[model samples]
Target chain A: MTDEQRRRRGRPRSEQAHDAVLAAARELLAEVGYARLTIEGVAARAGVGKTTIYRWWSSKAELVAEILYRPISIEEIPESGSPRDDLAANIRLIVEPFTDPWYGPALTGARNDLNADPEGQKAFQAQIMSGRRDTGRAVFQRLVDAGDLPPDTDVDYLIDVMSGLLVYRGAIWRQPITEEDVRKLVALLVDGRPPRRTPS
Target chain B: MTDEQRRRRGRPRSEQAHDAVLAAARELLAEVGYARLTIEGVAARAGVGKTTIYRWWSSKAELVAEILYRPISIEEIPESGSPRDDLAANIRLIVEPFTDPWYGPALTGARNDLNADPEGQKAFQAQIMSGRRDTGRAVFQRLVDAGDLPPDTDVDYLIDVMSGLLVYRGAIWRQPITEEDVRKLVALLVDGRPPRRTPS
Candidate 1:
């Protein structure tokens, strides 16, 4: 065989191997949680050497972070011609996975790990906060552009309210984010009853 | 000295020893985290037998859990007559200590450990969820009973919205909860504009 052929052929670092490692990490994170996950265990499960795993990630935390950092895109908002539908879709896309058995455990584990380490916590905050803020901003912007919301409305504040509710429910309450709940949230934000006067 | 006098004398089982153990546990939790904390280390620091701690708590998780489980009382909520003021007070009472330089790290470490263990995670969930829900329900009930909220309003749903926002800010956003933010939340829930209609 030619040198080039020899180099390209035989036991390529297998995309299969890469996927196995990530899958194992994800499973272990759910089962044993972030603190208990080990590089040695991940390597054993993936049938790869510890060196191979180390070559890719510096630590278990970094490996788990990459594995869980699934980018949730908001650009695909359904223009179902109804604002309510659009809002509901957005909420579902964000909140559904948060309640999934796998995702829920993984998320809770990651949060616990992040909170333990200040630096890790900061990284987590930066990654999630920007994405959520941007998505909420996009939703509000669409509403304003479509003349569905007031031009002078505080979009940032509105986004905070909507996103904040989702985060609170998922992280603190541990409640399943149901379709009905999302609908109620949209209704309250859009057409709720009159505000009460503050008592002096 | 008489037996009764002896029983009342000599510092009563050494509060100093108890304080030292807790202090060491707190420090080590910050430095090594909950996953790495050991009873041996705590015993060494406190200059006491490991049996002493074991007599009180079965495991490190239980000890940490006991340390972190604080009941929020009515006196903790400043009676400001306004819902917004009350909300701010509640938020402050919860967040302030969690952000304290010393207490924060230990709490975060314990939280991480709890997340790693399924049983511990369940306990953690029960504590936070029930606590938040009960507090939120009480506040909402007071408001509605006073005629500040509509008679038919869903207190449960409103509690979800309000508490969810606060939890989101604390756990996910990792932002410092301020009086202004709490006030805004109360205002938005109480008086924000209704959602606009989406075109059919």
Candidate 2:
């Protein structure tokens, strides 16, 4: 081991303390927002010393990034046989979490912070574009392989369009995204219906 | 006119000063963001006193709101004969302005502030839902009347979907939205294409 690694000899690290720190960070993020949240506040809230937090995470952005790394397993992407069903479930899962009263605010606050801070933005891009995008692209590829989609279809654009709609609802409109809404969106996009006439 | 209205005559409010203040506010919002922006900052930048700014707008929220009002003119919504073309154009105008280096950062910061501040959030709802919604709704209504859309289609849902996609792109993805992207999105939603296969 390197000298720095050798110096880190102890009880390794307390998983309990780590969880507490993350929970505290989430709570504070929800309450005060990222711009207002501080390492001291997190340390105090977690009942840990500032050194304890710094030992684990070099910065608040790193801590927040770790907190958001909620391992979106492949199993989370449902393969309900039909592409429409899978898409709807995907939409619901993504949208419902952001609409949850407790976690929603924290996620939104962290998201805003990510957009504003350069380092946070890069972390976010890597996490979503590299990590999440892989999962989404995989799901689309499955449907295309099944011959449900046209051979000429743009998979990346498809993923962007679907996820983009959900992002809009959660972040922009700031409205509740119902399952019915997801169904309509999936139907409208997948079914490719002509524009409807306005009722007189 | 009411007595208060009658006595509200001085040198009459200088439209030039009003425009200059808005310009300064927009510039600072692009530079410092909404949370850091202040009446004092706006006044100093605009070469006006704090009282002058306060006379026109009650708070920074109001000033930012007024500043945003400039881009919401009717002409920004397209009427390009086809719903697809019109929708594409409308989305382009809104999305394109945001891509401007100055406008993008300003909007990102403003959006962050709006979501974080309860009062600012309420103001956003009022402006977007009540004011912008009406304008958005009218345009879609016209599209429906023109028989470009199906009679049973939900325009409100459509608006939410379109806006949600753009919001997601700009606010969350931080991706540069292009006219081509807008067209592809329009085709995906309005053209009823099948879902692509998920990538591995």
Compute DockQ for each candidate against the true complex: 0.25, 0.40
Write model 1 residue lDDT over B1-200, tens digit each, in one string. 98877766766576656666777776776676566779998888778889987775556876665555445665566556876567666666656544544444455555555655667567655665567567766766666767767766677777667656655565455567666566666665666553222211
Window of ten residues with lowest summed lDDT in model 1 chain A = A191-200
User: Highest lDDT, which number?
Assistant: 2
Per-residue lDDT of model 1, residues A1-200, tens digit only: 99877876654566667778888887777677655689999998888999988776655765776665544557767577777678788777777656545554555556555555667666644675567667767776777778877776666666666777776676444677766677667766765543222211
Instruction: Tell me the TM-score of each prediction against the true structure.
Output: 0.69, 0.78
lDDT value, residue B88 of candidate 2? 71
Superposition error at A28 for model 2 (Å): 5.1
Q: Docking category for candidate 1?
A: acceptable
lDDT by residue (A75-192, candidate 2, tens digit) is 8976878876777766666665565454444555555555567775675566645676677667766666787666767767766667766766664556677666676766666566
What docking class should model 2 receive? Answer: acceptable
Output the number of the DockQ-best candidate. 2
Cα deviation at A9, candidate 1, in Å, is: 17
- Name model 2 segments beyond 4 Å from true: A1-20, A27-58, A65-69, A102-104, A193-200, B1-14, B29-36, B65-71, B76-78, B194-200
TM-score of candidate 1 against the unseen true structure: 0.69
